[model samples]
Target: MSLEVKNLVKKYGDKTVVNDLSFTMDKPGVYALLGTNGAGKTTSIRSILGMLAFESGEILWNGGKLDTSKINVGYLAEERGLYPKYTLMDQLLYFAKLKGVSKEEAKKRIKDWAEKLQVTEYIYPPAVKGKKAKVKKAEELSKGNQQKIQLMAALISDPELLVLDEPLSGLDPVNADLFKNIIKEEVAKGKYIIMSSHQMATIEEFCEDLTIIDKGNVVLQGNLNEIKKSYGRVNLCVKVEGDIENLIKEADLTVVNKTPNEYQLKVNKEEDAKVLLEKILQTNLPLIKFELREPTLHEIFVEKVGNVHEE
Candidate 1:
């Protein structure tokens, strides 16, 4: 199945928050919607999921208008959506039932997900010898654990289409890795996922295609690798036992960053990097590291957004 958002436009009275945003997921895999805070990423996602009204645009699923009521879809919102006073188990069951999952099936799925998310104790507290077991309430859990429960609620239905907004935002490192593994498993199961996160490394690891917006405007959209390739391998990183400040100036390379142990430089072309490499070797100062590679997603994001502001 394919998901397409075409020329999506959302405005609040006089200001447009998402302007002509468009992207397509032709097959099952992760598609990233990225932007800075208030850059319209969340608005675009809400419009696509039919959670918010849009002034203009068509969100199509499998070549037809997307109707959440008729299709199975899961969403993990950036803002936590849990009843602070409600028991976690009850909330999960309620969410699952809303998605038409049978009580027995919902409980089974909840059990499995609770185990996978490492929140079993909250959902199914160990029974005290003489007391009734009590399920934990949303407010009782830490933010990270609450995030896991929200994810569990999203996955309870095993939705064909999943939308995750900053899925790892408040997660600890261990839980973050757990979430990543679950995402990988979903991809392996051929699930269609649309993820929006500020984590460029995570996006680069999972998404093959992405759309980056800046102030409601589409700035960059395409296959991630192709985007990086278009920019070319202009990034150069080197480390040596001794200083190479003069060598860098000699090669006419722009230093992006420099520390006592390493130097991050920018070269206009591959040959410029080669010139720097030759200079370092000639010094015979124990070249520790010399690598030239494509600009990372973080760098690309900054450059694109920075350019937009400048324009």
Candidate 2:
């Protein structure tokens, strides 16, 4: 099945928060939506999930209109949505029921997920030999563990379309790896996923296609590989023992970053970097390392959406 979002528009007051944003996923894979604060990334996602209204757009699932109420959809919102006082099992079952999962199936799914997410202790307390075991409340778990429970809720129904908004935001390194593995597993299961995260490295790890918005306009959208290829190998990194300031000045390269032993330069073309390499070789500057590569996702994002608010 395919998912399509065409000419989506969302406005508030006089400003358009999301202007004619569009993309499609014809198969199961990760699609990334990236932007700075208030750049309309969240707004656009809410519109796609039917959590918010839009002025104009066509969101199609398969060959018909897309409706979350009728479709099996899983969502992990940026903001945590569990009731602080409710028991973990209670919330997961409730969420699963809302998604039309049978009670028996929901219980099985919850048990499986708690073990997979390493939260079995919180969800299923072991029976004490002579004492009673109490159920765990949402407030009882740490932020990271609570995030895991919410993820369990999202996958309880085994949704065909999964939307994750900043799924790894507050996770530590270990939990982040755990979440990444789970995402990979979901992809292996052939699930369509839309991920939004400020972590450019994480986006690069999963998303094949992406849309980057800045001030409600799409600054970049395409296959990640193709986008990086288009920028060419303009980013150059050079490390030398002695001072090479004069060489850099003579070569007319823009120093993006620099340290005592290393310099990151932005060249206009491969020829410019080649010229700098020639200069370094001629001067015998004790070169330690030289790298010419395409711009990183982080670099590309900064270049396209400079000082813009992230949403």
Q: Lowest summed lDDT over 10 consecutive residues: which window, candidate 2?
A: 302-311
User: For candidate 2, lDDT tens digit of each residue in 46-128?
Assistant: 99999899999899999788999999999999998789999998888899989999999999989899889999999989878
Off by over 4 Å in 2: 307-311
* Residue range 120-210, candidate 1, lDDT tens digits: 9999998899799877899999999999999999999999999999999978889899999999999999999999999999999999999
lDDT of 2 at 135: 90
Q: What does the lDDT read for residue 277 in candidate 2?
A: 91
Q: Go through the candidates in order and give each one's C-alpha lDDT.
A: 0.94, 0.94
